[model samples]
Target: MEVRWDIFLIILGSALVTFLPRVLPLMVLSRMELPDWGIRWLNYVPISVMAALVGQELLLHDGQLAPLFTNLELMAAIPTFLVAIMTRSLLGTVVAGMISIMILRYFL
Candidate 1:
């Protein structure tokens, strides 16, 4: 069978396109300082992103709108929030959340 060089070239091109932006920042000049507001808000970015991801995953079951508190995700979030506030660590929150969710899942 003949090798598909065209497909290989397309895959290689797609890979480079995906990688360029990720590598570009690392290749650029010295450490840059974000503005004061940016610096202040940077810490919240991860939590915000986490919240969005968790929210989407929790609220969207079977590709349809669902009730909030009537789900595993929302139920797990309570313990996760308390753990995060108590521990003040992302890993701790994640672990706590996962454990709670898994235990709940196991039971029901």
Candidate 2:
């Protein structure tokens, strides 16, 4: 059996590229004591990112804004938003969103 050195190098390089960006921040940040205000702001990052992504999905379709009743993304998002508010659980919100989208796709 012959080992492909070119493929092996590509795979190794890919892993390093993928891993460094994610781990390097943690390695650098873990040693520092962040201020309370900094910590509070950092905590909002996930929710901000989620809102950006969800807003993009719900507001855009075929390079245009979709109407509320005709938009599956908007329809699914409403229930997901409610679930997030009611349960306050990230996992439950995500699950409810997925299930809502799946049902909307199947029936509508």
Candidate 3:
């Protein structure tokens, strides 16, 4: 077997680049105490990111804003959002979303 040093170095460098941004913050922040407001604000980050992703997927088509009335994914999202809000269960929300999309696709 031949080992390609160039390919190996590229893979190692890519891994370092990918890993440092994620780990460096944790390493630096672990020793520092965050303020209560800072921690509270940080709690919204995950949901904000998730909303951005979901909103983009649901509301856009071909890089343009999709019509809300005619979009099948948007229709499916109605029940999925309700299930997520009501149950607050990740597994149930996922299952509900999957089922909602499946039914909407199958019927319409």
Q: Lowest summed-lDDT stretch of 10 residues in model 1?
A: 25-34
Task: Kindly indicate the candidate among 2 and 3 with the higher TM-score.
Answer: 3
Q: How well is each residue in 1-108 modelled by candidate 3, as lDDT tens digits?
A: 999999999999999999999999999889899999989999999989989999999999999999887899999999998998999999999999999999988998
Question: Which candidate leads the pack in TM-score?
Answer: 3
Expressed as tens digits, the lDDT of each residue in 1-108 for candidate 1 is 887999999999999999998888766623676688866787898989977887788788888867875688778889999999999998999899999999989986
Ranking by TM-score: 3, 2, 1
Instruction: Extract clashing residue pairs from model 2.
Output: none
Look at candidate 1 and tell me the lDDT of residue 45. Answer: 87
The most accurate candidate by lDDT is: 3
Which window of ten consecutive residues has the lowest lDDT sum in model 3? 67-76
What overall lDDT goes with each candidate model?
0.85, 0.93, 0.95
- Residue 107 error for model 3, in Å? 1.8
Cα distance off (Å), candidate 3, residue 104: 1.3
Each prediction's Cα RMSD?
Answer: 3.2, 2.6, 1.2
Which pairs of residues collide in model 3?
none
